[model samples]
Target chain A: DAMVIQNPRYQVTQFGKPVTLSCSQTLNHNVMYWYQQKSSQAPKLLFHYYDKDFNNEADTPDNFQSRRPNTSFCFLDIRSPGLGDAAMYLCATSTRGQGGGETQYFGPGTRLLVL
Target chain B: DQQVKQNSPSLSVQEGRISILNCDYTNSMFDYFLWYKKYPAEGPTFLISISSIKDKNEDGRFTVFLNKSAKHLSLHIVPSQPGDSAVYFCAAMTGGSQGNLIFGKGTKLSVKP
Candidate 1:
């Protein structure tokens, strides 16, 4: 079954400390996305990669960064964790075809807790 | 600045009745819409979708209606079952190669048996 997978379903990090949440996919999709979702809010796009070409949202903070080392793996690195950043991090993937109406498949999501 | 909005936070319906979830969007460039169902501790699963070219799209017991003029779209479920209870999210897509999606906050639906 081809699906997206995220590591450390629950993560705890100290304030100002660096934390990395990882995502991988067996779907071999051309596009991979990272979204931040707070309680009672919609998931916000942080960044995404299209076959290694990184596209960051204009409103995304500088503290957030991402790297797609290969086709199947992508990593989200928080330069310094903040209490306000505590939320669920979701990873999703989609193919490039279908004329921009592609369906995105999501992982279970990594719930981050900044102490 | 929410591009997509699901005004209702929650809704309840009796089993075997109809369930309607509505969503509105401010972006006119959005030409595609999708509805996703999510359970607690699980990722959202795609349920149904509609395109700007089409007014409605149906699948199984689920149907999606898109009204381009009003910038409103809705998901309709017939003969709702308890198993259908979950969070329903409405998402819209702009016409581009990226296929980035703007999503609503989501509406929690409870189907009582």
Candidate 2:
């Protein structure tokens, strides 16, 4: 089945350590997104790639960065992990084809824990 | 600032009854609205959506109503089932630079059998 996959469902990193989360999609969607979700809160858009063009949220901190090497893969890198950075990181994909309003398909999030 | 707001943190309803979830938005520029259902340990799945051009859109048992004037949208589930119990999030989108969605705090619905 074509779906989005996130590596390392649960990740633990020490404070100030750098960590990377990976996402891949089999759906071949042209758009991929990364979101940060705290417990019981809405998913905050971190950044996204529209066919290799990186678009970062204006409020997103500089510590968070993303890279999309190809259509199927995207990575989120945290320059320095902090206790406040612990949250669920979600990956989603969508294609803006004809009849536009495309719904995003999300992958099981990567839960990050910063010690 | 929170653009979308789901006032109810949780709601419980008997099976086969009607479940109504409400959402409000402060942003008048939101032209597209969507609802997503999420289960524990899983990502949210799209449930239904309504465009600003229309007041209502229905699919099977799910119906979404949008009031562009009031900046309010709602999801109604008729004959609710246990499988419908999950966290429901309301998201709004507007055309801009990135075209990213703004989501509200989710509402947890519990449908008892």
TM-score of each: 0.97, 0.97
Minimal lDDT window, size 10, model 1 chain B = B93-102
lDDT string for model 2 (B1-86, tens) is 89999999999999999999999999888888899999998999999988888999999999999988888999999989999999
Return the clash pairs for model 1, or none: none
Superposed by TM-score, candidate 2 places the C-alpha of residue B8 at a distance from the truth, in angstroms, of: 0.5
What local lDDT score does residue A61 receive in model 2, on the 0 to 100 scale?
96
Candidate 1 lDDT over residue span B8-46, tens digit each: 999999999999999999999998889999898777888
Docking class for model 2 is medium
Top TM-score hit: 1
